[model samples]
Target chain A: MKKTLAAIALASAMMAFGLPAQAAEPIDPIEPVEVKNPALVELGKMLFFEPRLSRSGFISCNSCHNLATGGVDNLVTSIGDRWAQGPINSPTVLNSFGQIAQFWDGRAKTLAEQAAGPIANPLEMASTHEMAVKVISSIPGYGEYFKKAFGDSKVDIQRITDAMAEFERTLVTPNARFDKWLKGDKDALTAQELKGYNLFKSSGCTICHNGAQVGGQSFQKMGLVRPYQTTNTAEGVKAVSGRDQDRMSFKTPMLRNVELTYPYFHDGAVWTLEEAVAIMGDVQLGRRYMKEELADISAFLKTLTGDQPKIEYPVLPPSGPETPKFNPWAPAAK
Target chain B: MKKTLAAIALASAMMAFGLPAQAAEPIDPIEPVEVKNPALVELGKMLFFEPRLSRSGFISCNSCHNLATGGVDNLVTSIGDRWAQGPINSPTVLNSFGQIAQFWDGRAKTLAEQAAGPIANPLEMASTHEMAVKVISSIPGYGEYFKKAFGDSKVDIQRITDAMAEFERTLVTPNARFDKWLKGDKDALTAQELKGYNLFKSSGCTICHNGAQVGGQSFQKMGLVRPYQTTNTAEGVKAVSGRDQDRMSFKTPMLRNVELTYPYFHDGAVWTLEEAVAIMGDVQLGRRYMKEELADISAFLKTLTGDQPKIEYPVLPPSGPETPKFNPWAPAAK
Candidate 1:
């Protein structure tokens, strides 16, 4: 009976240390996207880069969520309509659909829903759904695109967001070095990086940071073990739920392409990956990692960098005479 | 002697009426671009779309001179740094290389020279050449590009502008209906359009508006036959040449994609092509064109809309720790 107890104790200890768990892990590799409708995607690409959708006719979906720089504008926070500074860091749109819900507060349930919020936001694009539709519909060239994409020439807010969401779903980045390692490539990661991965798992970082996107699978409190200090006024999930307990709870930001999307965290208070990791360890895990351990973990995080989307900048159709002129300061079109 | 004099008068009348002059006309079709160095062009394209060159890190060259919409921002005058209004209209970059010089005032003799002006202009990009170079050099990914393009990894203002110029040279748009007609396609222009073309030549509009680019060949007075009224303070070539005679003298604007580039003239006062044509006739040619004549001439101008360049939006590299942060309010970097 003592031997049986000892055997159980050894098994539990091994699991805690992440020993012999390398073969089956919590993290999964990102899968390549399979596009079903090419025409819809093509139309969506045009709309994604169409700045005419903005009130100033200068901003677009790509303005904040730039595909060129790891699906982010790489700003600490975004600059919006007439250069109004955004409240929080613009999150990377890469593999964003893998998240259970959209936005840091999980307010948006789908990519399409998320796409609708920014277009009419006074601080962002500052254009209404009706105005956006009117501008697109008024253009003679977009008629053929609408017809080809939605089986009609009619332009609507629903079809617009649907197309954008479909295009965004195709923006998944697969086959990072970490993904290659997960897929059984023995030499994909360096010895130091592999050690860092094991440490990351054993230290319980993967509790909320797992799955294909690494961190977007769950919402977690910002400061679990210790209190966090920040000047940013955001109340996280409490802003949406109106619950005191949900005050500091936020959707875990995905780690994919985190290397390119810098000035880390919701407030974008942290600039370096090392500092971010150190803060995470102290406030979330109650761990004081050694210098080398922090470096190793940061190295592991860097391995999440993946291929970016190759998008041909679509030449948008010229505006027709009926298309409303861009009015940066005007109220939303009724 | 009487018969010989009558024959000369008939020849002069036929030339003035644009009869028997179809075979050898003033206009020439735009030639296709010949790209000699693909690497240089690729590097140039990346730089062209790079907003990091701006002090705000939000406005690239493509922001004002947008390739998606006839190479111009389509604004009356460009909205620049911190929403500063520009002095003059932004011209389309399409087929601009065919011009004798760059800018309305012809201040810059070459596209390479013109490329350097906006980067440090306080109201425009508001970034110094040194700062722009530093930002590009700090990015590790741009090193390979510089090396491939210039046979060295050294980033400088000259090489940067040169690469941009190389890319700009390839922005030529060919294969318009007018170009097809010039190349001997009989059905390229309809009956009304053909009649308009003849009237356009016979009315002496082709005196200044000629060549492959239609109008970029000469610096002509804005109101040659009458005093033009405008609230715009731009003195045109007088601002550059500082001569009283050069006042209101500007480069004859290109008409290649005139259909897409609306809000005509240096002040961008005229929104309709028909109104612009009527104004041009009254002010520049000293002739009052009838309503149907203006409509016909506008129809002829619409045929000049060529194929826009199909540019794949370049994926820019991530900024490094050493790269300078964007400061919209800051003075130029030393």
Candidate 2:
């Protein structure tokens, strides 16, 4: 009885400290997939930096997916269409290629398809594919680059889409401290970070963010154990699926670089990783974490941030002979 | 005329390389205000740690205002009662005391008043002030400490509110590199940061965020120039003030420690600081910023983040002989 009590106490201590139990096996690390079309990726980078594609002639993909501050723009939702608030959260492009689908609604099937949606969405880029093609084709430099990248100077909408998509593919975050630890470099993470990782898995975050991408494979309701009823308009899959059950069922976003992405969840509701984790335990898993454990989990999440890729804004595209007149979107130019 | 053009060219070249044309005037830096009552701050820190304050007895202020990643809980909006989404964006508490008012709507008159609102609001803490007082009174250690701090053995709602407010006041962020530069430490910021600062002032951000707090004194319409009309019901100040002129007039929030706060603005609308600055120029100021200028501004904003404060979570209060029942809307709670 004494020995059993001692063992139980030890286990309890481990749980309090957020350590994994001795019985569980360690997870094996998976290698990242090599990206194809490096040159296309380079072209995509130029396109991401170009604001001419936007109807406002002021925004671009990098406008929201900033490389300097993680991969996310750090806002809960992106301001687009003359500073109109977007309905859903903007997930980071970092490691997003590993996601099964794109967008909070999972409406787009691939990165290329996803690129097209935002460009044409009334609230986002507010530009049609044809308009985007026309804008890019009109730029002499872009025309030459398109021919070099796609082996055709046709400068069609599909090639532009392909180049932007290819650029997003190369925006993957690589080898975070956690990734290094998973690859058998035990010293990569602090003891607290490791403990947080264990608690993250045992507490059931792994249920959604388990794969190599850490998430982005499925859709889950915001509230699992308890019903999350809000007067806020139904978002996520419900907008696309039109099913009652799909209400508040947002895409399971990738957790890579999550520590850098403030205001977590579909609505950007949660503010800290610790708070989000604690709330998840209560609403999703029906459990509560000790303060120390929550702290550990937060520390672990910070290790996911990798170095931001360096990007240079492309030279402004010169107005072409056949370029559409720059009609000011505002009522009257000052 | 030739000499003037030559000077202009030189200045333009310097700006392109991310440098300022002139040295900045030095200014004295203000020290952070210290909390009045240490014991009360200590007690409030404990309350912040204790999840029992929530309706579910599983969430706390630390759940959202996590110290690890600035002060935000990192969700776009916080999850509260039954995991309901909060209406407004979560601002960082790092230098929140510098603000003119609390909440995005500027509804609360003081931090003490703001502290009580969340505890009883159905969508947030959901705990009545009476219940909160009773719970604290029941704790022996807390009861004793309350008497020492307020000269009463029993814990009243005002004392509870005051204690929490006192604790929150101590959450001041340390001075940033920008502050150091303003104090005449020339090497405090990089050349890019200095250029960004120039663009920030010339681009009209200084029109609102001037003075020591950077902002927090007024409210402004989001689309002052462009008039961003949207059918969405979340039209900021209009929802609070119910006046036509108040449409989308959100409180001018402080820019202190802004780089740490993601999802800028009251609605958490713009994601990156650069994107936010870009939108401010295009929609609010009726101007556009060059790409290099925007980059420089973003670099300068990063200098606003201060060193993290040193804080420790409080201990749980001990149980007492008598306990009062929960009452959310009591005058004392107010």
Candidate 3:
């Protein structure tokens, strides 16, 4: 029994710490997200860009996770309803489906649940689920599309979130230059990038940032070796789990498009890759990165940029008479 | 001498009030806006969609004059910075280049001049030209695009507005069903729509509304036959011309995509096309439209819906370290 328990612990550790050190592959290239329903995807695309979902009739999911700028809005944190500051950085929605769970704390297990987070957040879309359903129902063109996407004649929040997830599933960015290198194309990576990859492997970044998404596979402490001081009060899993053991631990974010997803990390305090790498070396891995190492690593990051999806703007339906008037700035009347 | 004077006065009146009694070709179809420079148009597209030009870095020309929704936000008036109400309804940007002059009051003589209006207006973008220029110059990606568009290394408001105008020049939507009819497609209009067209022509609606854009060729009194009731405080061209005669006189709006550009007229008080057509009959001409006549006119207007421009949303450059943090929600420092 003692020998069997020992074998089980070792197996679990190997899976948790990634494949054995000398294993052939360390990280895998991200694959494109599968879209089974094109009609559902189309409806989701319109809903994703529909600003009328917000109480302000202006903010949308695209406002934060903007696909035009590498599926991230490229802000330290997102500005939301009534100009409210977001609690944390907006992650790239490009390969979000590959994440073990959604959100920094892994609170939501699926993209559908994650999407519903912003729609009703007072600081975000500032709209209730009920209002969102009502508003969409009022728009004449949206009703038929919803019915076509889902068999439901009456639109609901569950259908709205599911369609949004279905559309986002198709937003995966494939064929980055680094991905080409990962598939055994020797000429794909520059000398600096290869050197950076070597340093990254030896210095232990791949321990957390591995697999298809290059990091979103598991949860780990943000500052294991040293405390990371930031004004951002997000305690990560502690807020969700209500346990001291889970404090300061967050779901590792994907780094496929790290070049464009700047202002790195959960706190979003660092602006450049060089600075972020240096801080990560000190706080997470307990290694001091030299200036040359930072430069090489940043060069490697740039190669991750893929072809941004060229989306033709959807011609939104004209507002119906029953639609609520845009009045975010007006004083609430008694 | 008396006969000659009488002939001269009659000719002047005919020219001012459109072709007299037996006017041929009363209301021509709108022509497409000409594009001279590809590079300038590309840069202008980025600038037109650049929300960073606004004080809040959230609203762009596309916010109000949305390409995704028939060039109009479809609101009674625009909601500006901090939710301030706009003084008038936003005009359609599509086919607007065909207007005799820009704005309802003919305040800006050219599209380039008109482009500069909203950037500085407190109720609009709420950003001064100096700040706009400074912000654009600060972004490294925008600086290079400007240089590529215009051979100037140093960016300024004039060059910015000029490039934007060049881009707006390409926004014309041609080939409406009405335009096809104009080009001698005899079967273009349905029986009801054709009757509405005949009524529109024979009922003196074309007296001021004659031209390529259907109405943008001249200024006309809002209520020539009866006093028009609207709570909107816009004094029309009188505010610009400082002439009592110009009071309640506005440059007639184009009707190319009237179906999508709803809540008709300058005040934008009316919602349904039927009611708007009825109001025009009572106020513009000394006649009242029957319910069926209003329905027919509304149906005919829907035929004016043109092929909308398919625009790929531009991938905006990431903000530099020097870029201002989005903090409209934060309290001003004491």
Candidate 4:
């Protein structure tokens, strides 16, 4: 009863101040992930770095969504199998479990589902599920890891994706200055950052960019007010939804660690943070910001840079004679 | 005086037993490297994983000499700049600092000198030293690291290579079963492994494969007795010396973690350790090994598998505007 009264009082006070009804409440602090099953995590980490999961035996999960550099390859678009160029910018895997769905189009509803897509993707890993399983099963050392991770030594695609997702769940980056500010540390952000936050709220940027993951709560049109020009031919959610209205709509990417994830936008057309901010304002909100305002907004965004996940590079098991040889020049398996 | 007397007594015993002059002393235990300057190592680690040193900004030193799986890519030959296939297998970087010289050709006398070759190789990183320097210099975070590592803020190729070489020097793989046996641990090797070691020494294999690194002391002809056959056009040491006798001669790769570093030999034609042992017996020793002998030699080689280097995946700094943009499609800059 006391908590309910306090909540009501806070809401009334927020209303009185003419602030957004959920002002200071939309953003939430991300907590560090705690692994329940260390064995599973250990196995998953090995799998994540295991290049045998790909047909080329060169690319791994870490190849594109690298944990070392903000969980991304830091490329405009990832270089894929046999140096094939990726069609879109690879999203950061950090804190992705908190998102409502996976991928820019939100095609896969879960992280595990997303994990399976790359292995078979013609331009990416260029591997069939059967071949991946065959390769893993052939390795004698992996059998022990599988037995430890799961109840048995079954090397199935489902188990593979599950373990990978479990490992990715631990990749949450916590303790950014913005997260500190959100957790009620008043001095965490600077005066300029505070002013920028106020401007960001007033300008209505948070309508789509809200909740725990900042922007992952909702899907929004790339150009709400104006057309966003790009050389990329990607049709956003329309490819998944097959709806004309969803043509330019995409899942609003999370703003956490936006500073480290460079070459912004789905097309990765923008390089600098300030430039991305300016373009977002002009295209999405149909507004122009002054240089000082841009600087403040950019400074505020920089505060989102969080403590990156500390990962011990796993020593992958050696391949046995049964393991299939990598065909670097081979086309994607049907 | 006591240690000298014991050594003399042991030498006399070996001579009495009709053992070779060096006998049990041929292979020495590898010692774990103790890092003195952590700051330099830290900086070098960042550079080692820094793809910005490549023209495409996708390949780092770890791409070919990966630390995760025995410090070698495990490919028959490395896939380099624009997916260009390498002419020879990449040697393991582990225990490489202990080598007489770097590369299969023993061209570069120091690890630092060898470090510069890949950055400029058109078929490899495809990056000029100037461009690499420019890119690294533009990143503000690297400046602080360089200052911390060298006691100055200068970002020269010399300091860069020096830092990288220092880091590579720490990549020694110690504490193998063979090392334990060498350190007087009687129970370290199994009966089969001990038998295999005896056969390995008696077959004259220790003539070239000896020392703490188990091979890296000198350059030897690939096929000492019989001619080796391979489609690979690499002329081995002849590429460096330009002498007829040095044509098929190459550096003896250190077999510290031979178990993990698979696809053995210069051309990486043989996949299995047993096969490699058989081929070596036929070509180098002028004798064909029986199946049991091959198995024994292979088992002995597996004892060389050491503790792999434990490394924390480093988080590289974000690229600045001043940093040159990566040209994934561009050819080697003239």
Clashes of each: 0, 33, 0, 0
**lDDT per model, in order?**
0.85, 0.67, 0.80, 0.85
User: B155-174 in candidate 4: lDDT tens per residue?
Assistant: 98988898899999999888
Per candidate, native contacts kept equal 0.58, 0.00, 0.52, 0.69
Write the residue-wise lDDT of candidate 2 on A44-93 in tens digits. Answer: 87777555577755456755665544555445566565555667667887
Docking verdict class for candidate 1: medium
Classified by CAPRI criteria, candidate 4 counts as medium
Poorly placed runs, candidate 2 (over 4 Å): A1-35, A229-231, A325-328, A331-334, B1-334
Residue A87 lDDT in model 1?
82
> Which model is ahead, 3 or 4, in terms of DockQ?
4
Model 4 TM-score relative to the real fold: 0.93
i-RMS, each model, one decimal: 1.9, 17.8, 2.4, 1.0
TM-score of chain A of each: 0.92, 0.87, 0.91, 0.92
* TM-scores for candidates 1 onward, in order: 0.92, 0.48, 0.86, 0.93
Q: Which is superior by lDDT, 1 or 3?
A: 1
Compose the digit string of candidate 1's lDDT tens values, residues B1-334. Answer: 2332353455468668866533577888888788999999999999988989988887889888989889998788887787677888899888988798999999999888999988988778888899999999988889999999999999999999999989999998899999898776869999778767777777788898898899999999999999888999999899898899999999999999998887789998888889999999999989888898898889999999998998988889888878876644455457
User: Rank order by lDDT, top first?
Assistant: 1, 4, 3, 2
Better of 2 and 4 by DockQ: 4
